[model samples]
Target: MGGVIGLDVGGANTKAVWRNGGERRAVSRPFEVWRDREALAAVLREVVAGVAPEPVEAVALTTTAELSDAFRTKREGVGFVLDAAEAALGGPPLFAFTTAGEVVPFAEVRARAPEVAAANWLASALAVAAVHPDALMIDVGSTTADVVPIAAGRVAATGRTDLDRLLAGELVYTGALRTNLAAIAPRVPVRDSSCPVASELFAISADVQLILGHLAPGAYTCATPDGRPATVEFARERVARLVCADAEQMAAEEIDAIAAFLHAEQVRQVEAAVRRVSGRFEVAPPVVPLGAGAFLAREAAEQLGRAVAELPW
Candidate 1:
């Protein structure tokens, strides 16, 4: 056997890992599947090519992209993604991990499409659980955050689906990027005064993180809200618009303050979810932070006074 490539195709990004003879390489690319579903095959091909020059022996697939608004139904989304993966990988032995924790063949996934939809979090959590017996997996991606509990070397998650995860406080919609500022808070402080935020898509979390120096211009893979450059200057300009104001109208320090406030609010939101999941375990477990926004996870863990374990990505 050559090696197995694991893929987690998401709505806003595509993540892949190539494992061969104990050597592994992982890569994530910005690919808005909803905006350009037809380009998925090309994106997949590019991602695979980045990690492995030769043909992969097999591919294990998982996805949250099927939940994108591009498809009318999840069945259609699953079929489309499977087709693209097949075409991109040249029909290598393919498998899809399901919410039931089963890796079924591509052919079997059609009948179990719902189970396979948005199950990437489960796959990640299970993989972590296999190594750490008692821990909380905090995966904060660009568009969402997952808080999954692992107890006794098993997945102690309460939710099997995204909806259920949301209800169970295991899934938080906030992330390191792409989240609307309006969703984070209705208003922000501006020099001792609270200013109402515009409900429009004026700014996203990426802009906030960019201005706060948490992310670099190149690290922001998602499209900017104003279709402007991802530079710190432009990001500051976007954050200024959250209050329906421009950079000229606000001082640089004022804009930075707003970004700092929003960043704290986001951390609070993720912390709430982390606390909810942590309550399930008898004793506090070490938090294993994963994904791009691992800093948020580490901060949340520190706030909860728990030990931290960084996931080797």
Candidate 2:
């Protein structure tokens, strides 16, 4: 193929990587499909154009947006997304990369929608296998982390569907952003005694990461839980509110402590799942991190005593 545009269309964010000969460029855009299902076509066009101003030979896709509750069922969501891709990417032939590693035409994929839905992990794992051969690949996105096990230069994942992946330690439904802090840490340490978090969406992983300095103002892509600025000060305020305290009331050290604890908890969650998945192999492979939250994956991989393999591609 002359130029290939690869897309991982997610519910909250759509990521595209355009590879033309030896040059590769990528772009990410936020698009909540559940809010405006029809806007996907426009997003697809814009995302593609952002990566490649000129037309490409093919559009390859791995979609997780089909899991959005906007559709009654995953089957329906897959068909809708495929339709949008076909319509928006008018001339290029559309191909859907399935969890089984086959690239089927968009038209045929509608019939295999169930298998094609939410196959981003498998797609990534397959790509990793082509490069690293044997690796424990983990992609920590905004709302989820995928732990895929590859062995012998093949996709050795035990799970295919999202449900199966969740059960097989191949999926941890928590990430470096957008995840409710309460879900990761029900209780955080306070100055004097441990305190239970307020069971509200006052803060998210983004806040914890921002407050802890893992994320910058510009990289905090998701909307803050409190609709405030993405600054460290605002992040501190949101994280403090997790314990139902204002930033002024809580010492900066205390808030910092809580953010650190929550960040560790997030890493612990992924690390546990990575251990479970990597342990399945006779010899665990190096960890390859992808996505915006690669920092979190690196932290988790280090805790597991695994090398963080670099992807030259």
Best model per lDDT: 1
Against the reference, the lDDT scores of all candidates come to: 0.89, 0.89
Q: Listing every candidate in turn, what is its Cα RMSD in Å to the true structure after a full C-alpha superposition?
A: 1.3, 1.3
Q: What does the lDDT read for residue 187 in candidate 2?
A: 88
lDDT (Cα) of model 2: 0.89
How high a TM-score does candidate 2 get? 0.97
lDDT of 2 at 208: 85
Alpha-carbon error at 186 in model 1, in Å? 1.1
Model 1, 1-313: lDDT tens digits are 3688999899999989989876998889999998889999999999988877787788999988989999998888988898899899885799999998999999878877888899999999998987788899999999799999999998999999999999998999999999999999988999799988999998899899888888878889899988989998988899998898898999999999999999999899989998888877788889999888888888888887889976655
Weakest lDDT window of 10 consecutive positions for candidate 2: 275-284
Q: Give candidate 2 regions above 4 Å deviation.
A: none
Task: At residue 56, give the lDDT of candidate 2.
Answer: 88
- Local distance difference test, candidate 1: 0.89
